[model samples]
Target: MSTITHRLPQKRHLVTELPGPKSVALAERRQAAVPAGLGSGVPVYAVDGDGGVLVDVDGNSLIDLGSGIAVTTVGASNAAVADAVAAQAHHLIHTCFLVTPYEGYVAVAEKLNELTPGDHEKRTALFNSGAEAVENAVKVARVATGRDAVVAFDHAYHGRTNLTMALTAKSVPYKHNFGPFAPEVYRMPMSYPYRDPLGDDGVAAARRAITAIGTQIGADGVAAVIVEPIQGEGGFVVPAPGFLPTLAQWCRANGIVFVADEVQSGFCRTGDWFACEHEGVVPDIVTTAKGIAGGMPLAGVTGRAELMDAVHPGGLGGTYSGNPVACAAALAAIDQMETLDLCARARAIGEIATSSLTATAALLAADGREVIGDIRGRGGMIAVELVRPGTSEPAPDLAKAVAAGALARGLVILTCGTYGNVIRLLPPLVIDDALLREGLAILGEVLAESA
Candidate 1:
């Protein structure tokens, strides 16, 4: 086993239960003051974090399997990230990249161009969040191609904004009441082999989607086809091996831009700099946010120079775009990723998670119960879907139980997927193996008991 030092000094220690009196009190206050809607996916209240451990308000130390929804890849409270942020804050925080451009911003963009999967001359625009990046990708595509229609896949989870929501597939939470969305945004079937259309190869599924675009919006009128190489919230659905390449080829032939939303899978979370590399697919545009800055709020769209330059000088920037602090943190984060070999660590984490979850799944099957229907993912970004016996029906109840059970035993896990039946793990790549194994052992225990 290998050992790594945590970045932050340990302070608050677990004294009470998972959510002690302090956390309960804070929750009550939050409920009274904050809106009913904006709490959190996981019930735990974070006070601080270091390495792969989250320190809760109640003083409970939890082994974090969810890296702040995959936003902190280097580690929570990374030393390089903190030092860079502090140094930049003392000098300058924000001048608005549009008003007074900064060197850090340009440096970060250069790093992105060098790192993201592409050999062509590329450019980048920084933003504040994943949703903003996705929205800007559409804008750039439209400006460069002079088209209005944007195509996305079924079971896709782009973002929560009007345009991105329309591009998103699920209705219950993301799109149910958010109607009258942006126009000309179309949805097509994604290549989900677990629940793929009958007699359809993944390539065929992509072609079917392209055919729908031709019939509905006409290829001449389409601006871009956006996809997640591995569907994040829709489930950790890894499309067939050739699916993305085939789609990219079609887009090239049609002169339609291909955008890869690597927001959740980028920054070494999936054992690679970007998920599209797994398929050798080079997207015309790539959007990345989570994990890019070691938890700082930063997102970017990197693409061909001509398409990016198509936007007018004042057309693509915001008041806070390319914030200096975020840019500095991002530079440090990228350095950490490289120096620590976090990509390889991500692959090791995935192997450990898959082995543990698959073993638990087998035990459940022997007992005539099904706790995990599938354990699938790449690198450190892994997921386990809970299902009812002999059926593919989503088992959200079981998922909730397992998560709560893990929490009670001092492990922090997160659940996602359209049905909320999938348990996704995005632990920091710098986590200690002993701690990682401890968390996985707890998860196995929870699954066995739940079954």
Candidate 2:
């Protein structure tokens, strides 16, 4: 049996400055070859990653707090993940599960069905990315309900694809100039407690949203009401405790499918197998992606069997839908999550990190400069919204400065929100407590300086 250890790998030497000579050289090459706007958020070059540390090509050993946008839940360059991928590659790379079904693919689906919330007989379909999973869920809902209208929430982010762009709420980068998008897609107000019309009353806000759906769109014409259980890109916004359950009840009563977009908040990222699980709400359809395959490109949509089977025999599949390598990696990732008790770790990390951020933000606020407006999220998926004093306005400049400051201190932090004023932390669930504390200390220092 392989021994399981909780210690993170030691950080090596940081010879040159951040994005040192080697990374600078690679960035230059990438700028010439890659598209102009392709690589902006993260540094261009990576030399190695193991456990919680990312070793850049410049030889800078930085604590990986971003986790590749929350995809590497089990940790970057995990031994089990590497071994599984290598062994599967040796055996068979791509058999195209659609053409010739493979055990690895079927096993992955079974695991997803078993793991995802909802005890009712569930069926799962695998896809290549979170975007594909969402697209498939939309397709299944449209076909199953025989309705054309799909309703998404404001400030929601589904994906970058054409159909998903219509579902997504952001327009500047995701939807700007990419329009002539899919039709019959509508947007509705989400129960944003921080900025809710009902003053943080989640239940009342949900009822208001439901009422709008009934009056404006007519629930009969709506195929599905899709939402992220805990908004990922909309700044780790966790809806009121009773908000999602109320919506799910409404969807069931009206026969409109409820799809939970768990792409960024699923697979133990939010302390449970799915964020929806926190509310005891079982969606008709759940889309999962990030953190599903230990960084491999794999996604899945699990839903009621009847809804999933609504598509005709040949309606739901892709050429590389369930690639064997990704399947094997997913199976191994699931094992790692279960064996390592990552869900509990996610909760623990969230408690520690969020508490630290909240305390630091309060201190800054007491100093007459409001540093954080809201600190909200469930489990490990947490965010701190930065704002100016005496108003709810976004502090984008401060957020940028804090992120850059953290990066300079050898820590990788990611910022997100509709206004880009929220500093989000998505460190791997397996991050050691010591490293986590160190990262939080760096963030506190940045906050103090920015204030």
Kindly list the per-residue Cα lDDT of model 2 for residues 1-451, writing each as its tens digit.
1235634465534567666777778888887899986747766377777767888867678888899989999878777888999999998998877789989988998999998887899889999999999999999999999998999999899999999999999887889998899999988888888877676677887888898888888999999999999998888888876889999999999999999999999989889989999879999999999899998999999999999999998889899988999998899999999998998889999899988988897788788877688998877788989888768999999999999888878888899898999999998888787788998998999989986
**Cα RMSD for predicted model 1:** 1.8
Residue-level lDDT of model 1, residues 378-449, one tens digit each, is: 998899988887788899898889899988888889888888898888888888777888888889999888
lDDT of 2 at 252: 97
How many clashes show up per model?
0, 0
Clashing residue pairs in candidate 2, if any?
A: none
How many residue pairs in model 2 have overlapping backbones?
Answer: 0
